[model samples]
Target: MAEFSVTLLIDASTSMTVTADTPEDAAELAMDEAGNPSLCHYCSGKMDVGDVYAARVYDGDKEVLDTDWTAQQLAAAEKQVEKLEKRVAELEQAEQDAVKVPRGLLECYLNGGGDWVEAGHKLRALLGGGE
Candidate 1:
């Protein structure tokens, strides 16, 4: 069966009364054997809303995957962000390098852009790929 998590919040005030199937079943079993149920009238009378409580039943913690797709996607996005930052720095430095040379040379280099070697190098360093 699939695992599931169920959180039940119960109010412990005078207006609310919480009952569980296990206790009710026990009471029924007592009634079947004896003339009266497992609980006495005094037991029911003493019951107060303060006895109410929140119960949680976690059915799927062990069977579920540790990391979901969203977590993987978030990690991928972090990598992409780092890569983009490096690319931006490379382009900025290239711009500074271009300023030192002739406009024509800079324009030519800009127009005929090569591979993303410079940006990739920087990103690789950021990602611990070494120098």
Candidate 2:
């Protein structure tokens, strides 16, 4: 068994906000069937992995509050939504820029042998796994 290191570059920033959602639908669409919804290596966030809902949506969009304030007659709700979309994109890019994952360091541990299993076993032991 080879030695491995785990390093996490978690953001301790106060401006960061995270949210999770669970979609009721899992039915594969035509694009999904054809692999159109591809997993983007660079675009992926920390919340990407275990999400039943779309993580990219949250990463790229701002939260619209439930309020009585209405969209103007000229700009419309669609325009507001569009503005939110743009904000989300900017935020997602900034988030990616702020945190850098050492993919090579990860590859060393993952591609090297038995590291994942060993780590899991150790965690299980800490959580009361018996001999």
Q: Which candidate gets the maximum lDDT versus the true structure?
A: 1
Q: On a 0 to 100 scale, what is the lDDT of residue 37 in model 2?
A: 34
Please, what are the lDDT tens digits per residue for candidate 1 over residues 52-77? 22222222342211133565577799
Where does candidate 2 stray beyond 4 Å? 1-75, 101-131
Lowest-lDDT window of 10 residues in candidate 1?
57-66
Once fitted onto the true fold, the runs of candidate 1 whose alpha carbons sit more than 4 angstroms away are 1-66, 103-131
Best by TM-score: 1
Q: lDDT by residue for model 2 over 14-117, one digit each (tens)?
A: 12233334211222221133332334677464323332222111234643321112323334777888999999999999888555334433443565574865
In candidate 2, list every pair of residues with a backbone clash.
Answer: 60-88
